[model samples]
Target chain A: MGAPFNYDVLDLTDEQVDAEVRVFGALTAAVRRLNEATLRTTVDHATVEEVRRQVEELTARLEKSMIPDNFGVSFTKGGRIRGYGNAVVGIRNPNAVPLTVVQDKVNGRASAEFELNALHEGPPGQVHGGVVALVLDQVFGEAAAAGGSPGMTGTLTLRYRLNTPLGPCSAEAWVDRRDGIKTIVKGELRRADGTVTVTAEGIFILPRWAREEIAKNGGTPPQFE
Target chain B: MGAPFNYDVLDLTDEQVDAEVRVFGALTAAVRRLNEATLRTTVDHATVEEVRRQVEELTARLEKSMIPDNFGVSFTKGGRIRGYGNAVVGIRNPNAVPLTVVQDKVNGRASAEFELNALHEGPPGQVHGGVVALVLDQVFGEAAAAGGSPGMTGTLTLRYRLNTPLGPCSAEAWVDRRDGIKTIVKGELRRADGTVTVTAEGIFILPRWAREEIAKNGGTPPQFE
Candidate 1:
């Protein structure tokens, strides 16, 4: 009947949104470095313990005042989105593969070029297969949104053809077609050399609540995952 | 024919492995707190920048003398593993949901009890669907390994039956059967109250090299994903 929850439309200037993106994006990048170091570090135990205490103090400083809950998708009066907590592309999520997909609305396509480092390994040097799925799900969702019929991921299928090594990689997805309320999106994961490693297809459907809302109120739904 | 990259069987003792786990695991836990604060913090920009500088300095201290590359699965002489870089269960990986999966080799099953906080949110208070798949993939792989047929994931299929609310959750997976070199694993994600929210099936295949090594050289394969 209505939105699920927390898709708040806020009153903020475009400049304000851009500043949040910049400041928070930088913080996320720094935290990712700390994440990688947490894995790869060979510092002495004393130094590590010291760093832990320092980290705890910094975290406490930030936690002095905080949000009540998750940073849900927010839209500005100017239509700019602050979906910064997304698991795939969330600027604030260190756990993210941390990708930003470019949506080409005219062609119903989405693509992103990013790097997978030591933090993303699965079979030794290769990227974890689930991480690939995480990135694909978001990209495919964006493609559905770009196609002008946004929805939730109904089902995603992936075939691992080869190993995706830890390094620079790219992904491309486009809407194949639409079937009633469903949009079928096709995509592939590629190595830096442009060799395909995984191919995926997903069916995204307009949720019944959103569909009912649209039928009753008559407006396009939010174009986000 | 040999193991892929860095699954090195090291010469460390159980005590050494235990100490490393304690230290690195603590570091990861601290980093995770910083990660959450990075998102939830509402302090002034000056405070954010100063915290960022401190984080960078701490990370640098840890990275002084680090491993050359990915922390591939390593085994101690006493039989404990240092797969601390895993995405789902890696204790050293802050990006991980950081669960400690318990393997029941006798029953060819594996399970874990963990929590998903605001960081794992997708649909407002609900856990992200892709995050659900990520957890299932790891649990299914462990089940295959426990069943005495470790392998890479060939294909994983998931069905989201209901929204898994953010908070405490548990996952259980077991070997349903084996088809030649392939092990079929089935699992489900449950909310804190034990309600099933997502179901999954994954096909894990012992790679050709490992299979050939066993067939030609005559021994069981490694029992770890």
Candidate 2:
């Protein structure tokens, strides 16, 4: 809303996006491995300090090479950001479950598939309840966006039907209704057995500034596909 | 009702926990800085590769010193895990917003304070809606636990009153009611000005196995103080 939500499509070709994806994807995997290492490492005090020193040196070297302030969002027409820099579905985020989302514009639906590991646990053997909510919010938000009514989340309600085990899972969402600039979306997270683990409903609203921008821009909604 | 929820407290001295917190806290901060660098770096492809190689080498070295399989939860008799290795409030987790939670045992209430950074952003300038849900779940779960009835989240409902800007925020939760083993908790996320950004109500259920474990262990509810 403040800066038109940065909807301008970046001028990047498919090949370029693919190349960036490959590189960033690898980097993301490395981070994931590093997280696991952090969780499972039990080195002695001296070794831990040694490792820290090495990492700090590397961090210092990288600090010298930086972009201007502000990490701009990269929006491509009919494409997701292939770089791992994306917060929701970015492969580079060790915290991310790295859902691969797909949108069906004709059906006003969105879905994603991912697997949670020990890294995402809450109560021992189960996936963290907060992680389930996070995934549902992302999927439902995508559904709202796919319905040609991109908006910010106004409310999200989740009912955990079962303890989502720490393993493979899938999620889907669809627009249930739309009222003016507000869209309601329904979504769920399921285990590999197709048993629903969590169900969610969310209301998304186009902010006043965004609504005005759309009106000024000839009433064109942001495209998800 | 699967495996008994791991509520067993570990026998660690305060000094030991403090040492772990210091070490892991430094590591977590470094990883957070690295994440920012990864997002904002504009170095040449070769340079990026070189940096990746260095990280990969460090990761490999750490991998050689593994600490068994699971990352055990650090639970002391009367203390929260100060180490950042905890999934929710752990400062060691670069992905975590690292909420500092406090529970009023007498009041049956829980409160958390945190600051969401660019790493937790979803909208152009707003905190990720999912992150809101995640924090609410944690706060509410803590509230339920603080109410002398520790349990797992069964449902969490959230109403976003506004687009929570990415910055300093706080949340609080209190027990609303209790039904058998289920506890209902109400909570809200607020800005420094006391503007409520999101409100939540969650149902937390003490599973059958956990109930039995409590009964067998003399019916003492897990302490949250």
Candidate 3:
């Protein structure tokens, strides 16, 4: 059987991919600003209403022509990924926490430095526990990939040790070990000054389809989360 | 000894609260539309840049005068809640999954009917696993609150039995049992057709601060996640 979904490995030039990254990246940043302003604004009702109308008009202009559905992860002939709809690190997703993970393939590690804001609050001024899990899941997946063995998250466990303040934060993860098809990942969420607030462990495994594909092609599958 | 955060019990009348809800809810919906368009649109680079400028201008209008930080959960004299910054079910939060959970206060049950679109995608057409955890965490927190034992999420575990497609979905959670200071909530994520795709159990606990407040003031803390 084939993989559960269709992923197109397209042929595109580096120049084209670079331009798309630049253009869409800027739009995503702008939308993120809009998201933050939407929460903190103390503007009056009339201003809010007027701004809503303007926002709708701009959205319509962009939506004139669009993809049929979500931006499925696509691979370029050059091996660049266009997983632009990812919730945690999608470049085009304004809902993301604006995380950019750096992979250390030699060390089987992944790390990110990001900021959380008013929109990410859970208990008063603290980051939402769910958001913390979301970011860690991504970092863990990247760590598994950095180790050259990747799969979907089968089980993720988190222990909340301390409250993470809503501001500058960092996350680091590394591949702990592997057992057959399963890769174990360990990681933590930290404050800017480097105090650990949460710790996590995740089990990642190749789904049946990926395993079957490997049996047939003897090729490793792309990293997925 | 204070509740770890300042919560103002305001004197806003019903009319004022209702109006704020209506106005802010509309803005949140509009921003959601913009978020989707940002990912799906196929407009040209010039058009994308133009839209970004327009979006930035409109956002500035909203940000002219704003709250210093997050919209912390507050209670009115009439008991209306102002938790507009919440990540899961916040009406004023565009990044929320747009969920409206129905609480069966009598039976310790809570459920929500919402939609997950392109922005929530992870594996091709399926919803992100972290997003699933995010939604279940909120519903489970609500279930604990409905049981008359509000608390924060101590730990959450999710097992992915199947992939949840991106579209209309439902979630239901109930208080499975309770121990001293802990509530165990069980729930599942289902397709619109009612097939369970993800099963979850969460442990909710009254934190030290909340416990101290309950001891001194002889009152239960509000539900937090």
- Could you say which candidate leads in DockQ? 3
Q: Per-residue alpha-carbon lDDT of model 1 for B1-225, expressed as tens digits?
A: 123443567899888888888888888899999999898888888888889888889988988989877777777778887778877778888899877788899999999999887688665566777888788888888988888878888888777666677789999999999998789999999998999988888889966754664566454555664
Docking class of 2: acceptable
What DockQ does model 3 achieve? Answer: 0.61
lDDT of each: 0.82, 0.72, 0.85
Query: What CAPRI grade goes to candidate 3?
Result: medium
lDDT of 3 by residue, B107-206 (tens): 9999998989888877777788888888887888888989888878788777777778888999999999999888899999999999998888888887
Q: Which digits, one per residue and each the tens of the lDDT, describe model 2 over residues A1-225?
A: 245355556777888777766675666677667766766677765666676777677677667887543343556665665334445675555566677889888998999888776566676557778878888888887888888887777878888877776778999999999887789998898998999878888889877765675687564555432
User: Per-residue lDDT of A1-225 in model 1, one digit per residue for the tens?
Assistant: 123453677999999888887887788889999999999999888888889999999999999998876776778889997777877888888777888799999999999999987788666677888888888888888888888877777777778777787889999999999999889999999999999988988888866654665566555566674
Which ten contiguous residues of candidate 1 chain A have the minimum total lDDT? A1-10
Model 2 alpha-carbon drift over 4 Å, by segment: A1-4, A67-72, A76-85, A213-221, B1-13, B67-69, B74-85, B209-221
Q: What is candidate 2's local distance difference test score? A: 0.72
How many angstroms is residue A135 displaced in model 2 relative to the true structure, after the best TM-score fit?
0.7
- Residue pairs with backbone overlap in model 3: none
Instruction: Quote the positional error of residue B119 for candidate 2 in Å.
Output: 1.5
Model 1: TM-score for chain B: 0.90
Error of 3 at A33 (Å): 0.5
Q: For each predicted model, how many residue pairs clash, with residues at least 3 apart or on different chains?
A: 0, 2, 0
Q: lDDT value for candidate 3? A: 0.85
